[model samples]
Target: MEVWLNYVFGLRPRNFWGLVCIPLFPLLHGSYQHLTGNTQAFLLLGWFILMQGIHLFYVVTIATALISGVGAWLFGPPNSVGVGASGVIYGYLGFILMYGIVSGSWIALLLTLIIAVRDAWRITGNKYNESQLLPVERSPRMGWTAHLFGFIGGVLIALALSDMRLN
Candidate 1:
C-alpha cells in the first residue's frame, strides 16, 4: 500500500524502501544500542540512495527479504528468530557492487568498493571501523551470514524487484 506512493512521485518503490525503511523491516532493535547502531548505518546509506531518486526499490527489498528469509530458514541456526534489516542491506550492497562491476563505471565501482571495505571491516568479530558514520561499538550478536546472504539476494533479485526498465 505504501509502495504505491512511489508511483505518485515518479520513482522506484525499491529505491524508497530498499534504501530507507526496508532495512528496518527485518531487524528492528529493542534496545537503544541496537536501534541506534542500525539507524546510523541506515541513515548514511540512505543518503547515498536518495540522491539517485529511484523509487521502485520495494521490489528489490521484498525479494531480498523473501530470499533471505528462505536462506535463514534453510541455513540459520535451528528455531532461531530471524529479524533484522542486515540481510536486505547486504543485498543492496551486492546489487550496487555488482552493478558497478558489470556497468564498468568508475564511480559506481569506487563507491561499491568503499562500501565493501567498510562493511568488511565492520564484519570482523570484536572490531569496529572508527571511520564509520554508524555506531563504532560492535555487537557480537549481529548476524553476518544474513548480511552476506541478503547482499547476494539483492543482486540476485534486483531486476525482479525493479518497477521499470532503464531502456
Candidate 2:
C-alpha cells in the first residue's frame, strides 16, 4: 500500500505524470516516523492558523501545498521521490511567523517566538547530519527545496492576505 501510494502520489521531479502530486503529496508519508513527526508540527501550526480563521487556515494549507509541491517537483534530486508533510509543516511555520509580523498580533507573535526558539535548528536547515550517514545505508533525504519554497510561499501569502485586509 505504501509503495503504491508513493508511486501514485509522491512528487517526482520533472516527470510529466507527477504533476498531480502537487496537491496530493502532503497527504502521503514514507513511513510511520515521517507521518508522526509531521502530524505534531502540522497540528500545532495548523491550530495557530485556525485560531486566526478557519478560512485562512484552509487557504494557507492549499496554497502552501501547491507551491511547495511544485518546487519539489521542479528541483528535487533526480530519481528521488518526495513524500511527506514536512514541506507543509515548514509552510505553516513560515505563515505563522510572517503573519504575526504583518498583522501585529501579540498572541501570534508570542507563539511564533516560542516555536522559533524550540525549532531553531529545523528552521535553519541544520536538523540533519549527512556526514554521519553510512555510505552503504539508504536514508530519506530532507526536502530542503520544498521547505524553502514553502516558507517563501507562506510569507508571500501572508503579505497578500495582510494587504487584502488593509485595503
Candidate 3:
C-alpha cells in the first residue's frame, strides 16, 4: 500500500497548498519576464530547502506557498490577478529567522539577515521604463509582503510540524 502511494503523488510534498497555487501564477502576471524571474528565484531557494530533507522541505514550501498566495489574493487590490512563488520565498525568510532564533546558530542567523537585507534592497526601489509607468501586471511584484506572510506561515508550520534547528 505504501509503495503504491509513493508512485502516485510522490509523498505529501510539503506545503502541498503551495504547489496547487503554481498554476495561478500566470493569472497574476502579464509579462513572461516577470514570471520567469520569480520562478527562477523560487527554484533556487526551493533547492536550498530541499537539501535540508525532503519531507521537511516539501512541507514548509507547500504550506508557505498556499498561505502566502491566499494572503495576497485576499489582501491584494481588488480585481488583481495574483500568482508567483515569492510568498514561498518569503516563507523561507520567516523560517530562517525563526530557525536561527530557535537554534541560536551563526550560520542560520547570518543567512537570514543576509537574505532578508538583500531582498529588502531589491523591493525598495522602483524599476522604471523610460518615461511611462508600466502596468502593475507587467511589473515584478517584488515586495516584502509575501516574505512577511511567508514568514508567518513558515513559523506556524515549522512549529506545528516538528522542531526545526538550522544546524
Give the best candidate by TM-score. Answer: 2
Which pairs clash inside model 3? 14-58, 14-59, 15-59, 15-62, 15-63, 90-147, 91-150, 94-151
- Root-mean-square deviation (CA) per prediction: 10.3, 4.5, 9.7
TM-score of predicted structure 2 = 0.86
Best by lDDT: 2
Error of 2 at 164 (Å): 7.4
TM-scores for every predicted model: 0.62, 0.86, 0.62
Q: What is the alpha-carbon lDDT of model 1 when measured against the actual structure? A: 0.53
**Model 3 Cα lDDT, one tens digit per residue, 55-148:** 8787887788777665554455443334445667657756655665665668867876776676553333344521111113334333344445
Q: What is the C-alpha lDDT profile of model 2 across 1-167, one tens digit per residue? A: 99799988788889977777777788888779778878988888898788777888899999988888888788777887788777777788788778778877677677778988876766544426221111222235655777777888888889888743211
Q: How many backbone clashes does candidate 2 have?
A: 0
Model 2 ranges off by over 4 Å: 125-140, 163-167
Model 1 CA deviation exceeding 4 Å by range: 1-27, 129-142, 158-167
